[model samples]
Target: MIGSLLYLTASRPNIMFSVFLCARFQADPKESHLTAVKRIFRYLLGTQGLGIWYPRHSTSFKIVGFSDSDFAGCKVDRKSTSGTCQFIG
Candidate 1:
């Protein structure tokens, strides 16, 4: 399931964080982790129309990116998690 979700993240970037979070417990997942994964699936099902689209023809191209990170956000390993996204227009 984690592998499938990771593949889907290539197009559905919105669920990347949730999917990766759930993946951390793959070796010893608890009931709550299972519930979280289920919730992510439901979210994807309901948001099927949401995704990035690129046009074939364009005169001008612009690139934009944003990134953020937290300090020691992970309770289990006390590691910071960071995320980044880019857009082209």
Candidate 2:
């Protein structure tokens, strides 16, 4: 379930934080974590039309990228978690 949600995050950036929060418990999830996951699914159902959309244009395009990372951000494994976003114009 978590894996599926994570994959969906590529097109649905709004759920990224919530999905990652639930992902932290993949190895030893509890009832509370399950509830949180259910909430995310409910949210998705409520906002079925939400997602990234690009506008149509003609001659030229510009691509921009932004990224950030934190060292040892993970509590369980002390691994870095990084994120990036790209924009086209």
Candidate 3:
């Protein structure tokens, strides 16, 4: 479930953080994790028509990229995660 949601986040920035938070618990998912997943699903259901849009007449597609991560943002198991993206100018 979470995997599918994460995949959708590529075009749905609004749910990125929430999905990331829930993903940290996949090692040993608990009831709280399940609830968070439900919340994400409800959110998607309520915003089904929502989506990303890029203007067809935008300027030259100059690209920029950045990334950063904490070794253990989640205090549970000390696993790390990274976020990166290329932005157009």
Best by lDDT: 2
Task: Please state the error at residue 81 of candidate 3 in Å.
Answer: 17
Question: How many pairs of residues collide in model 2?
Answer: 0
Candidate 2 vs 3: which has more lDDT: 2
lDDT leaderboard ranking: 2, 1, 3
Candidate closer to the true structure by TM-score (higher is better), 2 or 3: 2
Error of 2 at 49 (Å): 2.2
* Segments of candidate 1 deviating more than 4 angstroms: 52-89
| Better-scoring candidate (TM-score), 1 or 3 | 1
Predicted candidate 3 versus true structure: per-residue lDDT over 3-86, tens digit per residue: 999899898888999999999999999999999999999988999886555677767755689998888888889899988987
Evaluate model 2: give its TM-score: 0.59
TM-score of each model, paired residue for residue: 0.59, 0.59, 0.56
lDDT on C-alpha atoms for all candidate structures: 0.89, 0.91, 0.88
Residue pairs whose backbone atoms clash in candidate 1: none
Weakest lDDT window of 10 consecutive positions for candidate 1:
50-59
RMSD (Cα, Å) of model 3: 6.5
| Candidate 1 residue-wise lDDT at 47 | 89
Q: Candidate 2: list runs displaced more than 4 Å.
A: 51-89
